[model samples]
Target: MFTYVMRFLFCLLTILPLSLYAAVGDHFYYADWYYEILSETDMTVANLGARSASTPGLVYPTVEHNNKVYTVIELRKESFSSSYTFKNVDFTNYAPSSYKIKKIGDDVFNGTAIDPNTIPPCIEEIGARNFADRNDITSVTLPSQLRILGSSCFQSCANLQSVKGNFHLKKIGDGAFFMCQKLKTVELSYSVEDIGNDAFVSCSALESLIMPSAKTLGTGAFQDCPKLTSISLPSNLVSIGESAFLYCTGLKSIVIPENVISIGKRAFEHCDKAEYILFKPATEPAYVNWKGEAANFTDCFNADIESKMYVPSRKTYEHGIEMISFEDKPLTYTGLSPEISWKNNTPWPITVDTSNLPKTAGEHNVTLTAAFQNPSISLNIPYTFNIVKAPLKVTVNNSERVYGSFDQNYSCSFEGFVNGESESTVKLDLSYVTEANYQSPVGTYPISATLTPANYEPEVISGTITITKAQSTLEIQNLDELSNLKTGEGVIICWISNAPHSELSLGSETTASVELQKMSTLTNGEEAIQYRLIPINPGEGKVGLYASGSHNHEDAYTEFEVKIEDKAGITNVHTDCVSLITRPYEAIIIGKADNAKARLYDINGRLIHNGIDNVIRVAKRGVYILIVNNSRYEVAL
Candidate 1:
């Protein structure tokens, strides 16, 4: 009766649905002899061993009836533990046949003691070490929404033939499908730009490749892929990073599109079989060496040589191109009316006539040919002929013309050319208008010559002629004019231009040159002030102010009026140093009052000073009174 009751309880437990389990005791646990092999949950190990409790979600347990232990976990639960022993959980019915997978819950399966079986299709993202060495997976269709294939996802899956569409995949994570030797084919997404280094390194079966329009290729991307034959570089790529295609020995040729500006060193270095490395015509410097500098040789050509015109020496060729000049003298026609025809001397024919010739002078036409020595090519070059004649007599006409102070100068002449039969003449003319009134104007005038005759066309030539007014004279207008004169005043008055430098004069000191050194002025009741102009270069002659200096000075002084008198009778006579004014020198004193009185007398009692010129004129200069006390000084010269 107890056996019957225990059997009934076992049957009832199998019929009732299981609930999610947590604690070991709460799981559906049974005694070692009470094991049952049921598929109520559609799992081969449904009741392989007795459990304490049932779980709601997927319950993947490694159940072995012999061990009477089961390790289970609820799919929806965050944590759970597995049992140590199980029994009767083996798929002995499909032993060594590779089929033990069973569905325990919706879209869930347990490798429950992972029995070489087809994993449920809903398993999109496989965890690490999931099926590392499992060779049963010959082909797996990864979930379409599966973008990341974790490391070692299908590593060492020796039987993996191909990866089913992983369409939304952007990256094949590090070592995701590593060492899957049977992975001979793959349809990578267009969006995968970077195939990490060594990611496809040993993919020996990969022969042809199509790189996406990625800007830079990672290192060793295709290293050791010996079967790779040819490649087409993308138009927008700037560089192929290090060893990108190293050891691709079978590559024959590559078309490096112009847009690919740089190819990293050793990128295709070991692609031994490649013969024709073609690149688009680079607009800028293209090839770069190991040190990242520009490569030199663009194009090269061979050379061939024949006799006279040899190609330049090799040394000349390397530095720069060479050039030559040929001089051909006139060829004489000694034969009677010879038709000068240059034959096979050149690739092209050339001819000239010497038939209508003169007895004394001969005419000749020379032909030159240029050849490309390298390719043995030549072409004819042509030039003209000339007949000799006696030298012509050339001469300048209109030799001279008298130019007025303000007039234009004109002259004309002709050259005589005599050929014994007809004589030709060439005329020359000098003609130009003055720029200003030459009483010599402030600047020079340009003289121009024009040539004309039957044979010569009109031509012109020119030169500059300075214009300036005459003498070196001073015209002191007033005492105020000399007020701003300082130490530099003497230096300024030393070099007075636009006048005769030799005839230069100032004050009453007449000499070749006059400089007012340490000079000062004094006025007595003012009609005019007197400044003694001392001579620095002198022969010692009578002194007087010339008209030029005063008129041309910065103040434009006109003249001065004064009276000369005897120095002995002059009051207020002062000079720290004697000879300062050439003592007893011609005195310069302004009119004391409106009608100032004045007189002049030599030490010998003769009056050589007078107001005759309104400018006190003295035969011999000596200290004398410039009397302004006399009547208003007027010219007494």
Candidate 2:
């Protein structure tokens, strides 16, 4: 009779609705419910009541039946109709093979346990561990009240693509979410503090991740995630576990924060695409076990040629002076004789083998050896030096010249040399050669010239030119007003001179030579001489006489005019206004009308002036005339 009653109670419990179960405290305690309800297959709705003071929310417990133990599958809320009809569950079923329970309104439902026949017999406890490895799951939404994820909770969910919730989670267990190949994005709760080993490993499609509050990363946590391009680590993180980012080829660069103190071996090993590792420390960190032997943090990059480490310190292993120069000249031995220095400031004997240094102007490498004073320890350092050509020198010579009576040509030359070798003469360039008006002045004047060589600065030289007045003098004599003469008549004139010989010319005729003859002294004890002047044509002109000698003697000149009467009959002669003025340097003549043929003469009958125009230019101031046709009009200038 007791067995029958117990069987009836069990059968009645299985058929009753899940909301009829009373809540214990605030959260629904699955263990306090009847065993028949926990073993039901269709109890799809459950109510967790209000949050518990001790457990906060719904609590999963281990249930013992017969000689077997069953673990809690999952606890979640459920929707309901107005009349209390069971509605759908709210939590996502990421693991389809695992059973789930729900809280409908305030009532809790204990759904069916997973089929024992389908689960492997070796797995004794089937709950979080089994749910994590289920094959049918594709997506999941973790409960917000969950604080810690047990180990292997989501391992090997190959098709799992997305995960949401976990707003209050603090820690993720080892092997959680491992090998979820299709999983792409994850948004971690801000309160998460730790990630265990192999978490998210081999999640090839997982591209984005954010763990702002996580302080610890376990070994192989993010390894083999090829599509994971970027992640933001917590600012307070201090250490990284081994193989944390192994084979994460999409990660390009990472910055180690200042508070980080150590990194495990192979933390970034096989990250082929990572190019930069920036450290905030000014010097090397204290504990870096990345590589076994050298154990530098950079070694985890697997000797990638493009990968580099940036340190803020200026410290280096080398100590020496570097030389540079624009001129390609040989370096002296005295300049490079200083002993080699070590960072520890150890005194060592040094020797530099500069004999192999090339003499040609260019950069060269030399060997330097440093030996300990005890002669047991020695080191060799390779040094580089540069040699360039030396500067050039240029010089120009000054010049001087004496003035001559006529224009003349003069030249000045310069010399230049580069590196003590004379340059080609063709490269010499001079600004100018001759000085202008060299024959006109009788005082000192400045003369200058510039010389330029191909590779040297230009040089300019200036000199003085000196000129002196001539010494010889001459004077004219005989009657003052010597005037008319017949066409073929000759007139006598005299002259005085102190030169060797005197030359005479009539108009543009060929010169006539006159030899100086000795005579008695005159008024000022000056030598006196005489000569004859003649007129051979019926025209007005002048006879000019000049005394010539060497440059040491001053030249002398004198002139006189003569007129010859015209025997031809007058043709177009007319009386017209005529004017003339004669200064010591020049004479001017003007006529009232144009196109009048005029001839001018001095006391001598030489035709000194002839012009067909109204104005005529003459040399000396004297008495002259304008003879048009056969009429003669006298004028004084």
Candidate 3:
């Protein structure tokens, strides 16, 4: 009840003074009444050696004998000299005597309450806009009782470096100390929640800043001050306004807490020197809509660092292996003269799993990471492991294509490449084991290619070889089925064409059987016909066609279906069986026997392919399959 009554009486007193002034037809003039008195008063008239006389009723109207100025009138014309006496305003008996006096201008007083020696007749407040536009004032000491520094109180005080005191301040008004250029270091006290736009802008020399209690950096607050280097932002700070640090170039690195949602454009513009902005790892997978994958910010930012040279340690000439992984076996290094320093940030002697590398032969690149106290200089040492085991290489010499026919012959070979400087060799060991429903070149074949340089490890430096039995196709042709002919009268059953190292032993009729021969007209698709006959006998009851065209261990075989027909079937075979005249294009059989030796010939009796064929390119247009020696196949081209 007492508190409410006191507050009511205080409100009435404030309204009564304002009402009385308004009713008297006077505009409410908010000015320093004490300042006006201090400005124009003569405190000591008796001590003056009067060079300039104060004319009565001219300079000021002295009323009531106290020398108080109720109004000002035009001064009577009098010449004033430099030696005229000046009076200092005396406030010896004032209510607040020991206020923390902050001198803003030559005679302007922007002060806060001091330890009062006496009780005040009225509530004393900081004068309205009292400290306005005082750029010359760099240092200030506020009173503990200071409640407010009104709007624009310290606006545009560019040199104002330090502001101290004022424990009770609740708000700092708008545009307060807008461009305090020399004001680099600021100690913001409690309860300052809101700072207006353009506050504390253009303080270029600011090097270090710590905003422990700041809630936000207002719009354009620190724009265009290029010399700022580091800032310690509060984790609880919510938002930093647009263009807040737009042109601050000396800053090197920064971290944006997850709490900050948006960073305005041009807010970090022209800040090219800054490298690697750290951010909290995303809890949810953050996908890049443009890249269609989870963004590897580390890789992307590192690439940017490399291209722009923003990070001092990202220079291109710096040599370092990136990352190496061990799989299947611990990677072994040979002839490493300088002791290899196990790198990466992991605890020393950490064993990484290496059970995924190819058991046979291949090349792989691995990566690892290490932490260093000095990141800039540590990049010169690789954070990855590099080792070159005996490089394993597998080569299919024309490894892409091969084929064979029943009662035919074929050949196949293998080769390899070395991936490092190791002197290991891979020797081929063959075995004759038939499985998987077919007879194949089965063996525990071990092959490898060792690097010759003994220490250098190239990325793709190994090659190897494996020879296997070729797959064969089936073709049956006879002259008796097409033309009316007798089997006893010599009906040329041209079977064997150019079976590399194959043979056929006639089964029951070895005396009168199909022979191995070369037909001349069948080579180039020429209509005119000729034949080169090579006598052959089907040995025993089965005509076994064996192929030995491949490497020494890659020989194979295929059996042809036997046909026993009457004499009338032989003449019909000429007309219906093999249409040599109608076969489109010509067939050229260019193939290798043992030791990779081969030959090529056209239907026009021309050698197009050599024994050691370096480059063989076949263009099969409208080519018929050439059933050569009832074994291999040559497409008519």
Candidate 4:
């Protein structure tokens, strides 16, 4: 009773609150864009600012949402430069007037409560510090369409372990993952072109990096990263920023890309353990931010650390080219070396990248890098090649069509795509054709399934379509002859038709005078079925045969009369033709009766089915007579 009373009061309080003054719409700009719009579609939301209630409101007097009206409150104006405090309005359900959010503006999420975990695939850009200082977040898998990460977007995400899925990302803003101490791995998309200043600074746990398309490294981009054992730079890299690897002590060796034009001051200042440095370019690049004249090469590394350059006799170059078959596995560098230097006392190790190779057949380029622990040699090799598409298998599934059907209901399936691709990745033009038509006779016809392939060789696996004769007509041989049935006399009404609708049915009038018994299917398969009907009373009635049809067919029905006279036929006769039973699958015939010569005939006096042992079975409906010992007997089998 108390709970019900409280619930009633609560409902009353809720209803009266709608008239209260409240704010709505973009009152505080809590989100960079409306959360509902950002998470709902492939549309871009831009210029989303962090939530702020610092600016006083004086415009609205009313707001409507979900068909309920609320009075808006007015507040005194405040200075634009006034210090702001975090205060969010209940505008989660509010939609901005426009949905064209295209780019995340700078400093938009500096102090907001929004979580960046649900960034939709349609979102292409992220503003700086959007998720900075948010230690609660553990992982971030960016959308495939995201093109850029704003400066410090996820900086100080202490729990972040992996950052991936940004297949189209081109740039990483300054300090994007700065101080993210736990970040272990970074999977740079092949399209990434630049890494900004301090982008991954102080990411102490980072271990691996493979940037295949990167062109530049900004100042302090990877400063203080001690766990990065190796870095894969692309052939397109043009510059290395200052303090880039200042304290990357774990890097035992480094490779200067052949295209690098400049190296900032102290680029590898504290990389004391570095023993090898190889310059791939034939000419020395301008050592910007260094002393007036050319200092020792070790100046790029620790002052005490020795770094040597090797002149090339055995230079790195592209291998002989071959068009890759789509069916062939991704190419590996296990046996191929871009550079071999026997002059160096220590063995030079070459890294053949078999992993991250493109899976789909197409024209692609890869960077071949070789580095050594001593002499500090760096070599960058760029190789371009083509992958020829393999033959694709298209099978037109086997089908069955009605002999005269006009239904061009054809279907096909496709087989064979690479691990990273599917049929949807290619333009498929599938067409199916057969020589058979509606007037064609019943038989099998060949069907060809063809496709135009752009990335794959077209290999068609032909199929067949079988034209089956339709079961349009029903026949009961002696149906009209079943009008008269004696009291003890029974007839086996064989239900014959290609279409199996239902068992033989008796009309109300006939059903009242006769007892219908179920029987087995004859040797002719489903086309022949038998039913035994013995009259129990004298009356006139009707029997009906009905069938429902499928496509290109029509329903069928027929009616016949039946008359039963209340009199037994040879009920006292001690001789019978056969002791019969009706099992659905097969017939069970006992030994013949009386050991006499016997023959059976239809009502038209035609001979019954020809079988051994003088046995008679039902295959068609008719009046049957048994001539045994030249004596006559009538019964149903």
Model 1 over residues 1-637: C-alpha lDDT tens digits?
9999999999988987554323322324334312233433432333323232332222234444333444322121112324322212333433322332322222111223343243333333434444456677776665444444444555566776666544455455444555666665555555444445445565565554554444545555566767667665655556555566777788766545545665555666666676544333132213344345544332110111111112222222232112222233443423233333432332223232334433233454444444435323343333344433333233223222211233344433333333332222223333444343432323445554543333223333445555432221123223332323222112111111122221123333222222222212211221222333332222333333343335345443323322223432223222211111122334332221212223333223344333312222222232122322121111121
Q: Higher-lDDT candidate among 2 and 4? A: 4
Q: Highest TM-score among the candidates is held by which one?
A: 4
- lDDT per residue for candidate 2 within 300-378, as digits (tens), equals 5566522255432223211112111112344432222323222322222433333444554346665444333432333
lDDT of 2 at 546: 55
Per-model CA lDDT versus the true structure: 0.38, 0.45, 0.35, 0.53
Candidate 4: misplaced stretches above 4 Å?
A: 1-100, 290-296, 304-346, 349-637
Task: Summarize candidate 3's per-residue lDDT along 35-83 as a digit string, tens digits.
Answer: 1122224321111111332411111122112333233111111123333
User: Number of clashes in every candidate structure?
Assistant: 70, 28, 70, 13
Error of 4 at 543 (Å): 99
lDDT of 1 at 360: 33
Q: RMSD to native for every prediction?
A: 23.0, 23.0, 22.9, 27.8
Clashes of 1: 70
Better of 1 and 4 by TM-score: 4
> lDDT per residue, candidate 4, 447-527, as tens digits?
997777666777787889987654322112433323332233233423232435333343222212232222112111223
lDDT preference between candidates 1 and 4, better one: 4
The residue ranges of model 3 lying beyond 4 angstroms of the native Cα positions read 1-130, 142-151, 165-173, 280-637
Supply the TM-score for candidate 4.
0.39
Candidates in descending lDDT order: 4, 2, 1, 3
Q: Candidate 2: where are CA atoms >4 Å away?
A: 1-130, 281-283, 286-294, 305-307, 314-637
> Native-vs-model 3 lDDT?
0.35
Candidate 1 stretches greater than 4 Å from native:
1-146, 156-168, 177-186, 213-220, 232-246, 254-270, 276-441, 445-543, 546-637
